[model samples]
Target: MTISRRSLIAVAAAGSGLLALPLVARADGTLDEVKKRGTLRVGVTQAPPWYSKDPKTGQWSSGLGVFMGKAMAQSLGVKFEPVEVSWGNAIAALQGNKIDLMFVLDATAERKQAVDFPATALLWYSLAVLARDDLPVKTWEDLNKPGVRLSCAQATTVDSFLTKHTPKADIQRFPGNVEAIAAFQSGRVDAVGMFHPPLLAARQKLGKGKLVVPTPAESVPSSVAARKGDTAFVAWIDKAVGEYYRSGQTQKWYEQSLADFGLDPKTVPPIIKEMIT
Candidate 1:
């Protein structure tokens, strides 16, 4: 995953000139407002193996969001400023100009109608029903049966996926992943609906085996999003992401980061790499 010197220079050139474009306006109608202010505010959650804090330094680490923010800032020649937010607060943070970009966001049709998604298919995240090995739930279809409680984050893509495909299942909403996992551990829920990486980490930490099943087909891609109408910013971001993908830097980051979290990079489907390439 090496970037050629020529491509690196081209990316740097693009970043330096992105601000000169009149169309690269902020969500509030100002050009490169984030850069003009000298900081790129990024939205992220505190979910482990996805987004989390370094207890010793009080700095952020360990998530795709962190890497995405770092890469975005480097490509755009801006300072990276992370805003730790809950799932509930993420969208408002973007709309209120508290954050310039939301990473690890699900690009649903409903959300796309509001936010500008510059990087689509950044990661092919799977929705899974994580359950203790003792549970009978082994697949997406099994989770749809009656008397099974499925816990998920509120207003998340998992919720929407469940609503659309497993409408009959009893769905429970938690404020965040911690509560959802807590409920599952307490036997209050039959299974927790979550993304793949976090579920794998949780199982490792608990020293228990958890079963994970992919969501039914028709799930959306996860993406990086900006406020609606920020076409210039979106275009600039699109170019940066394309360059990163082509350079193979993204694959390198994935391999290293996933290994750090005790997850297997081989779990990423080959088709996802093809799509990004």
Candidate 2:
């Protein structure tokens, strides 16, 4: 079904959790509590295209996952409250039982120890590179040489990606994207590795960097996360996510989010083109 902007808002607003009922969990865990409490607590982060906040007002708005979370809650007849979490804390927040759902998570083996994923990927993302246009790096091989400086967020997928793929590069590690971007800006590093959409935002901020979806165009599946061990709750979420894909809501909102963020539709990472399948 085609979704209008008005319908998107009304649905998201309906589950904004402004009037949360008292949480009452059934023996089934979060699924029952979500339905009973009338609020689906969704963990969000400042990751662009997934979640973001206005710099001036600090008011949060749509990221693809935010819209998807709203739809998932709507399907369950519950509202979803966006709970902010840091990238470093995403796993801990879920493991500690701080949030009922993680709207965007990759099903890595280490993470699967703590959380369960749906049978299908909610989205796919390519590890992207943002670099000075004039850098000698024109291919993945160029960046895989000694003294070719690269920046990555410590403990993030990009860090491991670069470590594995560009081992000879002098990889500088920082606590998060802010520091990684700063490192790139100050000439401490020649390039930065992360996902594409956020790299697009970084390109705009830096004003002259080139966006590169490294050759071979690799991408990974990204999924939603729920605490492990509760097969019933996990199965319910799996079915809900599967239905979300079937309804065509995913593509509609994904395009809208890209437009809202001003990313060039032509340059969207290949994984985006592969999402609906």
Q: Provide the lowest-lDDT 10-residue window in model 2.
A: 15-24
Q: Model 2, stretches more than 4 Å misplaced?
A: 1-26, 54-59, 95-97, 133-191, 243-252, 273-277
Q: Best TM-score goes to which candidate? A: 2
TM-score, every prediction: 0.61, 0.67
The local lDDT score (0 to 100) that residue 267 gets in candidate 1 is 46
- Count steric clashes of candidate 2: 1
What TM-score would you give candidate 2 relative to the actual structure? Answer: 0.67
Q: How far is candidate 2 from the true structure (C-alpha RMSD, Å)?
A: 10.9
Q: Tens digits of per-residue lDDT for model 2 on 57-165?
A: 8766777778878888888899878888876566656655678878767787656655678787776777778887788655678899987899989998888878888
- Residue pairs with colliding backbones in model 2 are 15-79
Which pairs clash in model 1? 50-63
Please give the CA lDDT of all the candidate structures: 0.66, 0.73
User: What lDDT tens digits, residue by residue, belong to model 1 across residues 1-277?
Assistant: 3546764443334322221111223345423676677777888777655576778899887666788678778665778889877765565566556778777676666555445787535656556667767777544677677787888888987888887767888899999988888888788887888766567667657655464554343333567777767788887777776676667766566666666667666643211435321
